[model samples]
Target: MTELLLVGIGTGNPDHITLEGRKALQGADLILIPRKGPEKSDLAELRRRIVLQSVRDGMDRVVEFDLPVRDPDLPYLEAVERWHDAIAELWAVTLAAHPDAHSAALLVWGDPSLYDSTLRIAARLDPTPKVRVIPGITALQALTAAHAIPLNTLAGSVEITTGRRLRDTGWPDGAETVAVMLDGACAFETLDPDGLQIWWGAYLGMDEQILSAGPLEEAAPHIMRIRAEARDRHGWIMDTYLLRRTGVPG
Candidate 1:
């Protein structure tokens, strides 16, 4: 039976990798790194550097696969589903080619549970590989740590969700802290800016990271500009943010 290990590598910083994550990397017989073309080559390079620095054994085979691109012609959900299916197929082919390799690992950006479909794709394999998830620092954790702020207000709760959910559902009821990710459009513009504070970060934990926080109204424009410039320069951008209601918890 194929054993699949999904290792969370955190947001772009090599140091953000946990001790357990490093150990998982060292233990893997093969490491699968996904390439999203030249536009996102830096992402693949970062994972390579982390392996070079963190793996105890230097010779562990590292494999790269071209990531499947989502079709723009299809609806968003359908496009993503198709894209994930294609990725799963590539994974199956790679695994079959390396039949001798046991304990294969895939380096996941941030945690696998958050806005990432690696786990779901893995589940679709023919025989269904035995999966193990090694958690690492998530983008939300990295964003909060970079700013030196607590993720949740004292005695309050935080709601973690995606940009699409936020845009469709609006502000979550009874949620004082809302974290939004994978949002290309500034969804904050749809909400009431009054009494709302936002902490936003792009490329968290990376050298080129940009962080800003304050009233949503005041910071939204700056976030948009920074996001645009970063995407233009890098051809891609990964960002996350936290929104908090103005009033303190009682």
Candidate 2:
């Protein structure tokens, strides 16, 4: 049986990769890195660099593959399924290319448990490989660490959600703080800015990282402008933020 390992490398920082992830990288017989074209070449390049750093024998074992684009015209769930199927098919082809290898690893962004689909896609492999995950620092952890802020205040609960959900439904019930991800649109602007605090970061943990925080009312506009400018400059952006209800720790 082929053994599949998913290693979380964390945001874009080399230091963010955990010892466990490093060990997994070193142990793998094959490492598959996905390339998302030139626009996101940095993503693939970072993984390649990390592997080189972690495993002395990594370059020969590494396989770079193209990622399938989800057709934007299809319904959301349908598009995801089609995209995932294509990826799984590619995974099988890539695996077959190295018949002698029993163990393979993929470099995942953030902890595999949070907002990542590597595991889900792995399930689609026929006679699925025995899968293992090495957790890395999540975007949430990196964001909070970069800003020197606590994830939550004194036992207060936080809701983790996506940008689509934030825009569809305002703040969730019992959510003292909301950590929003996959929100390229900056959905936080839709909510009433009164009595809210927002901590925002783009490209967290990278050399080009940018951070902003304060009362949501005053900071939202500034965050929007900066976010747009950064995305335009870089051609892509990955951002996450935490919005907390002011004085609601009681």
Candidate 3:
């Protein structure tokens, strides 16, 4: 019975790791770290650092495997399904190499419950392993904390959505605030920006973090420039932002 622990490492900051997550890392028999190509190798490196600094070394083995790349030609959902299947096959193969290990762990980027695919991929394993999720700080928390702003207004509801959805749907009904994630494009530009105030942050908890806030109209261009410049400098960037409609009642 392999116990698969998905430990959340939090948005690129090792200090954001929770005590429970640290304990899970220590308890694992093997830890699988995925290498996402040279451009994103820093991601894998972060997990490596976490395992090195936290995991009790005695009998625990840390294994690094190359992650499967998704085909861009396929439709979004189809490509995702194929990608997950490939990853599951990769995982099975990785696990087979270390047949003696009964328990394995993977360090997730943020709280696995929020927008991460590890849990979904874990479900695809054969004779499925018992899954345990240890939570960590989320990008949303990092964004709000960095700006020192409340995610919601007085008694106002927040709609957590992706950049694509926001771009397609314009603005959601009922919710006074919309927090956007996985937005490579500055989708907020599609909105009227008449009464919306946006708080944007990139590399949320990392050393090169950037924070910007103001009325969407005034701040949108600045965020776009900053995001582009940061990406140019770092070769990659992870960002999230919150958009609030001004004058919305509680």
Candidate 4:
């Protein structure tokens, strides 16, 4: 049976890779990098850079494959599930092509245990390869570090949710602070903005990183404008933010 290593590379920073993650990459017989199309070519390039920096053996074992796109016509959950199946099948085909490779690695953007679905897709592999995960810094960590702020206020809780939920369900009941992820839409604009403060970051650990913070009312428009400009410039953007109700002690 093949061994599959899911190594967390962290957000756009080579140094964010843990020693364990680097070791996993070096030891793997094959490294699979997914190409997410022209709009996000930088992502694949970043992974390639990380692999070259980590592995001493060169690119002989490295392989690149096109990532499957989720169908817009299908329901969200169904589309994700079907897309995952296609990825698993592709993985099997790629691995089968290299009979001698007993260990293969994929560099995950953040910890697989977080919002990532790599582990779920790996479970679909027929014959089920032995999966190993090497944890790395998460975007939340990078965001908090970049802003020099604590993730949670003193003696308070932090709720993590998506932009869709924030827009549809409003603030989670009784959550003093909420961390929003995968928010392409500025869902914060939907909120009342009263008694709210926001800390936002995009491209969190990279040179192109952008940050905005202050009362949600005052910062919302600025964040939205910059987010649009950044997305237009790069063709893609990954951002997360924390919204805290005022009156919470630091």
lDDT of 1 by residue, 140-231 (tens): 99999988889999988999988888888999999999999989888888888999999999999899999999999999889888889889
Quote model 4's TM-score. 0.98
lDDT by residue (tens digit), candidate 2, 1-250: 3799999999999888989899998989999999999988989999999998999989999998999999999988899999999999999999998899999999999889998889999999998999999999999999999889889878888789999999999889878889999998999999999999999998988999999999999999999999999988888999999998889753
| TM-scores for candidates 1 onward, in order | 0.95, 0.98, 0.96, 0.98
Candidate 3: C-alpha lDDT? 0.89
Off by over 4 Å in 2: none
**On lDDT, who's better, 3 or 4?**
4
Candidate 4 ranges with C-alpha deviation above 4 Å: none
Model 1 stretches with alpha carbons more than 4 Å out: 56-60
Candidate 3 lDDT, 1-250, residue by residue in tens = 3899999888988898998988888888888889999988889888888887787592258888899999999998899999999999899899988888888989999789998899999999997999999988999999999999888888878899999898989899876899999998989999998999999998878888899999999999999998999898888899999999888763
Instruction: State the C-alpha lDDT per candidate.
Output: 0.89, 0.92, 0.89, 0.93
